[model samples]
Target: MRTIAIGDIHGGLKALVQVLNAIEVREDDTLIFVGDYVDGWSESAQVIQFLIELSQKTNCIFIKGNHDAWCERWLRTDTVDSTWYLHGGEETMASYKDVSLADKKAHLEFLENMPFYYLDDANRLFLHAGFTSMHGVEKEAFETTLYFDRTLWEVALTLDKRIKRASAFYPKRLKHYEEIYIGHTPTTNFDSDVPMNAANVWNIDTGAAFKGKLSGIDIHTKEVFQSDHLPNLYPNEKGRNKN
Candidate 1:
């Protein structure tokens, strides 16, 4: 019954499939996806449809992401945010051109129902981005921060290795969970194409939205599984690489 924390997928359905196959997921394994399921690659709509079906046979927990929120809003209201459009939403919109209205409504409901964060029985916290509350996620004043904040990751990255959890210098937010698993900030941004751990926070987002691979990690054993780089899988697509 291993629990795996999957990183931001960003609509790379092929990469998602590759990682899941690499994991050789068993019937009892729990898959917790730390969001950004759409926007970026060419299969945004297909990816949503796949997940919707996959959840029926597997135990899965989905966390909401900023991009997902934007896509959900567009699906519900037909209003596109310019910022979202610039950041992979254009590709997401294109992916839905052939999808039926019924499927779109179902997908919109899926996105709308996802929680901003999830806490496992082991006290492990999983979220798409980060939270700003020192008292933990429940105390977060702004729901948006859970899927939009980067300060949590930034603080974790800058913490001194010498600082013990019991020490006064350790960040209060880090102490709230047995461990924190997050996506949104790609490990590739720091030059690593694999999952990176800073303090007690594990960032599994390997930048599938750009030039990196999609990644997943076993929470207990810390075993990483990755897909071929998105560029390799999607050849002609630029993904979210503006250049």
Candidate 2:
């Protein structure tokens, strides 16, 4: 059975479907989504509903993302955060305009129950963003950092390729996992539209929220599956690029 690490979706349900179809998902394959399931494109609510149903037919692990946390709060309290509203939450709110209160409550529960990070039996770590603790995720002092931090990726990128894991200069955080898979920081930021690896960390977020494609990678083989660019799929939408 193959385990696939899917990148940040950001409400592109069409892109999500295309990527899954590209992967040709089997009954035994496990799909681990790194998160940001909502807030960006026009299908935020539909993406959540699709994921809820997908999990029932196959094994899936969903990690909570910062955008998702903001959406969840709005769903539960009927109040919007200005920052969130500016960053694609407005689109997310619009997507749920026709959703029933009971369906919203169920979606809220799904978001509320997601784990911040997941560790597989192979010691691979999957998280929406990054963690700050040198001792690993369990020792993280602030839960918010798990989905909001970028320092982890920054540090990984700066590490010298010559530095061996056994060397004194190796970051303790990177040493904690056999391999780490993360989303949140888009690979497009580095001028690439595909997944990028820094040190032992694999960043799968291909920036589907903006102009990039949704991506998924096989953890063991490192085979990548991508959907058509979001802009191509939704011609009239600006997505989060409007921000």
Per-residue CA lDDT of model 2 for 1-243, tens digit only, reads: 999999999999999999999999999999999989999999999999999999999999999999999999999998999999999999999999999999999999999999999999989999989998899999999999999999889999999999999998999999999999999999999999999999999999999999999999999999999999999999999999994
lDDT of 1 by residue, 34-100 (tens): 9999999999999999999999999999999999999999999999999999999999999999999
User: Model 1 segments beyond 4 Å from truth?
Assistant: none
Q: Estimate each model's TM-score.
A: 0.99, 0.99
Superposed Cα deviation of residue 4, candidate 1 (Å):
0.5
